[model samples]
Target: MQQYRNKLLGKGCCGTSYTQVTEELQELIFNHVNREHDRVNEHRGSETNPEELQELIFNHVKKDISQSEENRGNLRMTSGSRALEKHKLPSFKNLIDLIIDDTVFNNNFLQMMGGMTSLQSIEIFSSDISVNNTLFDQGICKMLHLQHLEIWANGLMGTLPWCLANLTSLQVLDISYNDFMGNISLSPLKMLTSVQELRLSDNHFHILVSLEPFFNHSKLKNFYGPLPIQPHMSLKELDISINSFHGHIPTEFGAYLPMLQTLNISRNALNGSIPSLFGDMKSLVFLDLSNNLLTRGIPEYLATDCTLLQFLVLSNNSLQGQIFLTNFNLKNFLYLQLDGNHFLRKMPDSLSNYSLEGLYISDDHLVGTLPRWLGNKSCLIDIIMSKSHLEGPIPLGFCQLESLEVLDFSENNIIGSLPSCFPPSSIKQVHLSKNKLQGQLSDGLSNISSLTTLDIGYNHFESNIPDWIDMLSNLTCLILSNNDFQGEMSIRLRKLSQLRLIDLSHNKLFGHIPPCLNITIVTTAFDFVFDSHLVRIIPLREEESVEFTTKTISYSYRGRLLAYMYGIDLSNNKLVGVIPYQIGNLVGIHSLNLSHNNLTRPIPLTFSNLKQIESLDLSYNNLNRKIHSQLVEL
Candidate 1:
């Protein structure tokens, strides 16, 4: 056998052959393992009493095994094991708490455990949970250790268990988003000195009770959601939205929630001006009283005091009067939606200082020119002042606002040509219709490649249509109508393939109508000729006879002729030529007045085509031949 020492030192092997080294190594391994085992056993023996240690380990394992067995039994019971017999159940005398959040409402379990003296917390949150008088009647008052309880979203019916008032140890209670419908009295919660959070939102609680208890509860920090009207509450966050709460905003609201950081009283019929005391709530960060009848001007004191506010929405209210920005110190405002108010007049000048990213003042009767100070708000992305009474030219300063994306001043009194300096790269729509403006269309307008709709109609403008208008590739609606303009229609107009409307009427323009105009989406009422005047009458020539044809004739002779075709009044002109026979081709003609023109011959027989003629006037023409039968009526 070879003896091998565990130590790392150079030493001669103790009487062992190399062939037997393998067996030696195995023996050494066995010996080392045995030694380590012995050492561990010795350490364990010195540290703890063996019997006590064994007992502790056995108890832990046993407890785990028992708990597993108990869980198995509970699973069996839940799985509809043989109906639990009341006598088979163990006594619940030591039960200190019970919480059930499932479909299993064990009636026998409740009956057996209701009398437990140490039962403290009773929390049942389930869709099937039902609350009745029987729970209280069955000795629920015995709960002594109950410090906090919450039963939410349960389909519980009937009044809250009256015995809840007897739970002196309760510190918190939440029975919200449930089907409970009844008068809620705070008397039961008055004794809960240790309560910190109470939530009863979305419940059918309609009665008003004394709130003095909640007001005095020093530890209460959150009393939120739907709540019955009470004098006051010691809350840091309160929400009474979506309720039938009416009457003016309670002036003491801020006083009661001195530490409140959020307060939402929206969706209520709350009326009257905002209470000035709201300015005292220094801790408030979010205040939403929207969707109410709150009237009068927003309190300047509150706006200045709530400098830390991030969201202050008072929309859909009767709030009126100018927003006095000088008094407001809004440094952290992110969203301010004051839309749907009947507030008239200009926005406060101090609005230029607001750092609002999203602002909506739509549907307000805001009047006067759009404030140029708006350009100072460099952070504004969306500004909707639609349906307002804003008038005058769009401020040129708006072109400087590079951050503006949605700028809507539609349905307003905005007049004048769109600013030539308007940023061509950013503007999307320029709607300036139904106003009193007079100017040639801006040649620089073609620079706005982003333009989608340009409506500047119903104005008095005298200028040729800009040829550059065809450059707007994105243009969709082009409404230029009811104005004073002249010149031949532009051939370039045919290039506006995206045009949806084009109206040009009631102007002085002459020359052949552009043939390309037939392709345009245009609706016009144009008079091709002006009223005629009188010229000197001339003698008839024996060699030339009166001629009529379908075509209009220009006379070289200085006299007027009276022949019926289409009615004509070329009464005064230097036009000279024999009336061609084509004039009589106008069979639909009703009247004729070539009366004050140059010399002409006897009336042609082709006048028989004037069957529809109603009036004739050859009075001032030079004619010596016998009158024809067509002239008998004259």
Candidate 2:
């Protein structure tokens, strides 16, 4: 292979024959030139000296040399040009950047790089060749002094090669995810107009390309797809998302791109509305129109002209009225998703006018009340307004948010209590389950200590199960189910060593039950090597949800499969005795409720090791004997 890439660039071995190759292609050309000189001396720049510029950009680009696997079982790429006419191939004048990835491109390997006219960047990817598309105009667009071209995911099918308009000093044209279909004619890319990063995405085109020929390009900055064009007011990232593009959203694209910054036309079939000239795009920053079919509402000029807007996604659109936080100015907003809209009222006490950090107005059937100026939003962190029929209380100025962390007011009608001034150190998930929230439980919630999900289930919470909730040592879901909670369930709840769900079901609790509640939390098999600490203690709540009442309905476990939901629901409580043989040590429980408890079961044969039981209720309780035949194969 070109005298083993010119003897790994110390050029010697010129007249050939260092035993003419194959010591596994000379140890894959000296381990890809010492792994590209240790990846360009690991990004040099300590005032330069990457082994004196790693032989000028590591011999000017060539990746995975000879893609080895023992020379692909006897050099096959149609093993034609008479098996590379007995070696000695590589000569590309003085390579100016050539990357041949996932190798194998035939026609004698494109006639040995068609004598690279001092090539100026040519990337070739071969998805196992699948040859015959007329060998890309006799090999790599006849290299008219090419200027960066990437042939990606190379299963390149027909069309799209009208000699790439003679390469007109091309400036990066990435043929993306290729299988290119027919008729993509903008008159052969209109004399290339100095194409600036145009990636024809996942091809299967039929585009006639008239976005006024990309406004006669003067450096189109990043344009993907031939779909519904418009890019090129010196574009700055415009992703024509999942195409089949329908109407609206082209009111001269914010008066002509103006260095637009990231606009994704999400999953299209896009219908009207949502274009108050996209609030006059003042260098807009990330605006994704989610799953379209959009309608009105949401146009106080996008918070009064996108002032450096940071991530505003109009979620699953249908978008009706009312988001008048005094015609927004967004103050550098950070993630404001108007979730599945139909919006009418509520949520606008000028929404503390932005210092936001993730606020998704969920299932918008929004009604009045929730605006206690949202307790002065101190850079709020995650407030997903669920089921949106928002009602009273919760605003003891939300203890000034103090960098709040995920508070989802579920199925709202939110009544009083639960704002006894909390901010006890960055709260972690407090989903007000099916709200009608009545009091108790707040001795400043044991000062929060980074709580992991405290769901106030089926509302009206009356006191006691509180021993300051065992100081929440990172609790993993402690849902106060159908409340009216009466005393005695605390054995300091085994100090919650990262609990995996515990629901005080239909409470009025009478003693027993907490036999170290099986000391929950168990995921190991090296817990997938702590996948970023289990995605930040189970966060990946896609469109938020968290209700899991077994057998008596309520499933809903949103995201990351709610971290593999392990469970415990002290069903219909008035709990008396027995049942807890350490609750079968919980063996990674999957729902096990002590049904209508006056519990006197001869049950526990350690419940036959639960083997991750899927719902076992032990009905009405006081069982007089028999049945523990290892719980009869569960």
Q: Which candidate is the best by TM-score?
A: 1
User: Which ten contiguous residues of candidate 1 have the minimum total lDDT?
Assistant: 54-63
For all candidates in order, the CA lDDT equals: 0.55, 0.67
Candidate 2: residue pairs that collide: none
Model 1, CA-based lDDT: 0.55
lDDT of 1 by residue, 1-634 (tens): 1123223112332211111112222111101111112111111011221111100000001111112233323211111113223224334455444444333333444455465666555565552423355455565655666676766655666667656767766777877666667655443555566777777766677544345545557777777555434444446777676667778776776765566787787778889989987887887888888889999988877888877777777888988888655667878877677877888768877766767666778778888887888766777666667668888887777777766655666567777766676644566655454466667776667777677556554566667777787788766445454466566556676576554333343343333323342212212221233111111111111111112211234221111221111233333222233454544654555445554445366775666666666665555556446767874653
Taking all chains together, each candidate's TM-score versus the true structure is 0.45, 0.34
Winner by lDDT: 2
State the lDDT of candidate 2 residue by residue for 291-409, as single tens digits: 89989888777787778977878788898878765767766877778878798877676656667677888888888778776677677788888888888877788877888888887
Q: How far is candidate 1 from the true structure (C-alpha RMSD, Å)?
A: 30.1
